[model samples]
Target: MALLVLVLSAIPRPAHAEIAAWMVFEVGSGEVIDQHEAFRRWYPASLTKLMTAYVAFSAIKQGRITLKSPVMVSAHAAAQPPSKMGLKAGSTLSLDAALKVMLVKSANDISVAVAETIGGSQAGFADVMNKTARELGMRDTHFVNPHGLPASNHYSSVHDMALLSRALLRDFPQYKRLYGYTGVQYGKRLLRSANREYLRRVRGANGLKTGYVCNSGYNVAVSATRGGRTMVAIVFGAASGLERAAKASALIEKGFDGGGVFKSHPKLDNLKRPGSVKGLPPDGYCRRNAKPKLEKLMADYAGSAPMRAANSGLPGVRTAFARESGRTRAAGIATSRADTTIPRTRDKKVDWGVVMDRLIGAQRRSDNLVRITLAIDPNAKRAVPLSAPSADDASKNVADAFGIVMPPRGKPDSRPATQPADTNTNAVPVIVTVPTRASDGTPTPRPAPR
Candidate 1:
């Protein structure tokens, strides 16, 4: 169950059960038409790569990185999950081919390769990501990796995603046509699009992204134009692909009703997830609370936030919200064409910011609401904080949220220097949960984002 884009027979419909969506019209014009769960904290999935692509493209436009830039494939990048171009170690690709594969197939490895080649390592590129998010004003978004892989801290909302869409269309019009692609051919393999049905159902449906994670559920960000008017539609927590498409269509049809982008209430707290934070990189500031965490700070200043569209009346949206909303957990999907269904678990409890970061690589971690579904199994049952034993990990982590009272790193030399005998200062190692293997116990190599 790779997160590959697949062919669909027909357009999708709204969920028969409870679900939500968010929509905006005339991006810079501040017009919104229809919406449901616009602000809901769903997985951005691969749609996050849009920003990754945008950043890379921007670098090229600015004469920083070029299309001919030869990015290398590190062992770490080569180890990424699948849907990839299958480059081996010592292999190199031009920025152009890498970007194309990323946008067309949503390749995860390629994304990392690009990040590493452009920004250095995954961590270094993350700094660039945070800065870009701040500049774009993605208020509810935080990126931990270049390729969106469903890390807890990597979460986003429709409102913030819409903003990125607008910026891409406006600021990066030179690459605007990249998103509207129906399909592309690579190495004798004709890669089709996951948006064919969407293109058919909507009048001016051009291009966009889709996403899904067990916790985040079915998410989508779409754009279309008609009658000299253009609009973007976003859906989160949908029951299925059918529902996602249907709701997007409804928003597009309803939105176009007003002659263009219209005005409707937006989910104000979309970025307001159950967490605290200091803004990401370059210009850091804290936005933590009771159970404050890095997420709060990172999300505090994301541009294109639901706050910008405070009047949008949509469900599942919030300026800040808990990990789970009061909706049912939709079925888990493996690709963009998976069947849709209403889920049962929608508990608004813990924060999922870090979880999202672990999912997508840092680059695509925006609140973009991707429409592609993934086989990334939800560790819902074992979903708990990873803490060190001796000193209360929860308490220490909790304190770190409030301020620098407890920095992320403690004095490594802090130990009981017994005068009687020789004592070692070696500390216990941090417990990092290992990623689950694919169903067949194989390492999944994800392709770049489509």
Candidate 2:
């Protein structure tokens, strides 16, 4: 018993499930390659901008707007928190420039500017977004804002994001260049892409987006093509940007290695959501106190010194790798003996501290801005009415306008049932455990019955 206990203690185990939800699917066939907790709703962060872009694309396709259309910033848009272009109210950029800045810089201001230009108001744009989500069969997603600044009731699943990514590639292949940009040049400043690191490190990586907020840890939607095979990987709630990139890289490699049209595996559209999976709450894993353990976990899982060495020169990344590599060596975990040569870059150095400070400060700034806006701007408060009529209510209203009597809500019909309940004794019974909700609204996982 002592010997068995000692062996078990020596075995490795993950400290935490750092990635809350993920999915990898083949673009050509829509075949699901691999997925984990794919259906559980989680914060979309800036990935919400993808949908915002999609709606804009649809409007352009319908001749309601054009790429050359001018998008002007408003006080409301300029008031948006950071990760922005810092454009002042009344400043205008062409729709094309707006898309480039929004996707590359993940600009909150540009997102709202585009929303206002195309949809008239932020709330109006949100209605269009929700409609587009339904049209695309993204049942688990709801968008309350365009820029994905933290908001209650805004959520998406990896499954839905993968679908959105695939849709963008399929519908607007011409815009593929937008996602792959390293940086976009505005009048005086060249704004770098948030996804530049992934594009540089991952082979065949091209387009997509990255997002972060206190509620949602680092999130990325990456699409890559190799040997004529394209794969899309969506990861939500990773502990850090580095870990998010590494996990995405791993999943993409796995997909290319073992993924294809598996006849038994369901297509992306047909893949069912796991009934009992619960959405993850914010873990605040990016906080200073949590870095050591998470960094060590990243080093162990990465298993490649070259990978770490190659990225060591990135702004704010070298220190993390330095500490993590030391611990990795002390633990005697063998890493690949491949080349440790650090790649050189001629691009200007980035001050990662300022970037991270802006991101971290956004939540507080946004909260304050919201309170101030609501107090001073009565129009903003009226923009999104809390008691606005739903689709069902609208339908009933239409019926009443035509003097038609609609059935009362939840009233059982007097008519006989058309179909009988299934009574087959030989059928296998599948049990699903429903997760309960905590007082804070986070889903609490329940144990399954035997």
Candidate 3:
């Protein structure tokens, strides 16, 4: 009880000030370590690329495409704003290289480029992202683009983001190395990774991503491993990148130490979520003038063990040039070669085609029935008149227009047809007696009677 109170007190409440939501969870155990407004909707910014990477990875694994496949850059892709790799229109790169550039640089242009290449259009790719997000159980996420650039409905919650982070890490272990890189090299110009702060500073912190935009402030979904345990920490709506990192690092430390008071919290699926609220804008909290305040917030958390032990001062990794500069070193590039034979490992339990066919099969059958009915001669004579069933007969099965019955054989009618009939002889008997009497005189009377 005391421990729960301590944890409850330590964690900020939703109504507390203007701090954004945060959450920490133990990866394997499915225990929610601590949370504050974890399910509130927030703009994901560049963190949207996590889903992009997931979809691409899924495509590669499904054999629909390949890592070495060429991704052509379109004018649309080249036009995305900065935090981009300066990719030009009409240029092309291997999917593997494009992913490296996007993940390390958080390049918006490459994100669009990759989406277009894989989905044939950005709209189509967004559809795939949302469908895949649903499959991964990210109920509170809806994306409008492959890149995390802000759009009206492109938003996700910390719970949803953490679920995605867990899915990416757990589902695609072969790509685990992708999360650790601080940057990637192309030709001559070195490209730096966007998440160098956490990668360099926090012990056991390897990945996964960070994002910022005017609406989203600074956000990150980070995973780290110590001893043998892995934990993911999500921070949203921080005042600055430093604050985001600091808070994440602090939560991660708490997670590793198993310091939460509550024995368990609601599962990710059960967490409360935002309805239709708009995301918080970063202008008020993340603007240039807010740096001092943000820094002061960071100072308070700096004394935490994780921050104190962090190696944030370490120099970032340098990679060789892209588009012209001499080459630099890249950490954690794909070890699995595109040229090597990839084993077919797609799931066998669920055939999407079969599921879709089943969903529409009944409707299609009904449609065919309507078409057949329309194609028949309208003037044709009716085979039988339609009528309502009698009250007692209502409970009985009736043959349809086509004579289909619930059971192939119907019950034989056993009632006698004449059982309700009786001769009406009383009136005719009197007339017969009169005719016998007139028979003698019939010769004369018959004519008058006629």
Q: Model 2 segments beyond 4 Å from truth?
A: 1-17, 259-264, 280-289, 292-299, 303-450
Candidate 1 lDDT over 355-448, as tens digits, reads 2211110111111121321122222121111111224432332233222254356546555676444345785666533233333343333223
Backbone clashes counted, model 3: 12
- For each candidate in the order shown, give its overall lDDT on alpha carbons: 0.55, 0.68, 0.64
Note the clash tally of each candidate.
107, 0, 12
Question: Which tens-of-lDDT digit does each residue in 336-393 have in candidate 2?
Answer: 5421222122344433322221111101111000000101221211121212335554
**Against the hidden reference, what TM-scores do the models get?**
0.56, 0.64, 0.62
What lDDT tens digits, residue by residue, belong to model 3 across residues 262-348?
455666556655565445454434543244342254235533433223223334532211111222223122222211111121543
- Residue 286, model 2: lDDT of 47
Candidate 3: worst-modelled 10 consecutive residues by lDDT: 365-374
Distance from true position, residue 353, model 2, in Å?
Answer: 18
RMSD to the true structure for each prediction, in A, is: 18.7, 16.8, 28.7
